[model samples]
Target: MDQNSAKEGKGLSIIAYITIIGVLIAFFMNQEKKNSFTFFHIRQSLGLWLMYFIFGYVISGFDSWMLTYSFWIFFAVLFLYGLLGAISGKANSIPILGDFFQKLFKSLGN
Candidate 1:
């Protein structure tokens, strides 16, 4: 939680938001150091990617461009929010599902 820790983990934390693969890479990379900042972003990105895939499957059934665009935009904003937080070395969570992600992935960094 200290600035030094955050600074140390900043690169991997940003990488965590790149994609699900990035999440895996970041997770494994952090295993050695066990950076909490990196793990926090990993959990957030993992949850976001999982939700995106699940919702994308459901959204595919709909032919509405509005729904599709909305889905894309929604996830985009959330990703951006998390990415910026990581870049800034802050541990802020995504808006609504952030708390759930932290709780769901509570065992991640342990």
Candidate 2:
């Protein structure tokens, strides 16, 4: 990729990992100027956020301390992993969820 593409990819990827709102912002940002690298990160970030809310709710049902702490730590590690990949302009998937997210959110467009 060219310098501009790499720079934009990194920017989009970083913004995508920020928060749910950042994900939406990055989505629109890429609408006009599509970058596969950035799109890859967007899907991964969205999946992480989804896992956060979904698993968080499910984990809340349990009163076990070990489960709670492990749940948070597990997802935290995944988030950090994806964030580092984005910062490096890598299209690396976020462990298991990476491929699923890409396939699931492919309609999100270029």
Candidate 3:
């Protein structure tokens, strides 16, 4: 991305990490600026966040404490990866689901 585009998209990019609220803010913010790279990361972050809640709910049902803790730990790792991508201005996917999110939300931007 060029400097101008990066500058324009910086607000949305930063907003893309505050969980679900950030997702909504980024989406609306991107509407005017419309940076593809920033949009890609926003969509990817949204998917990861949505999955995080789903996984949290599923894990909560498990009776085993160890399993619950492990699940949350894994989610934290993924969240960190997504955050790093947003901060670094790269659409780097979180290990297992990065490509999947890119494909899933491809229509939103491209």
Candidate 4:
């Protein structure tokens, strides 16, 4: 990547790790700039955030006592996967729901 591309990618990358507000800002900023690397990270980060919310909802509904322990483990694994993907520049999906989020947000890239 060129200097401009690298700069743009860096901005996108840092923004992705922030909370939802940062993600939205990054999404719009990248949209205006039209950076490929930025878009890739945005998609991944958005998917991560979406997955977090979905898991929160489902976990809240469960009544099992063991589920509390299992939920933290599962969330930790997913968090690690997301953080690794963002840091390593790999487009690998987060275990189960990653692919679904990609498909769901496909239109956003267009």
TM-score of 1: 0.99
Clashes of each: 0, 0, 0, 0
If scored against the real structure, what TM-score would every candidate get?
0.99, 0.91, 0.86, 0.72
Model 2 has an lDDT value of 0.87
Backbone clash pairs for candidate 2 read none
Among all candidates shown, the one with the greatest TM-score: 1
Ranking by TM-score: 1, 2, 3, 4
* Candidate 3 lDDT (Cα, 0 to 1): 0.79
TM-score of 4: 0.72
Ranking by lDDT: 1, 2, 3, 4
lDDT of each: 0.97, 0.87, 0.79, 0.70
Leading candidate by lDDT: 1
Which residue pairs overlap in candidate 3's backbone?
A: none
* Candidate 4 off by > 4 Å: 1-7, 63-65
What is candidate 4's lDDT per residue for 1-110, written digit by digit as tens?
35466454765665775776777888888777777666666776788777677877888898876887787788778767766665665656767877776787777656
Query: lDDT of model 1 at residue 17?
Result: 96
Which regions of candidate 1 deviate over 4 angstroms?
none
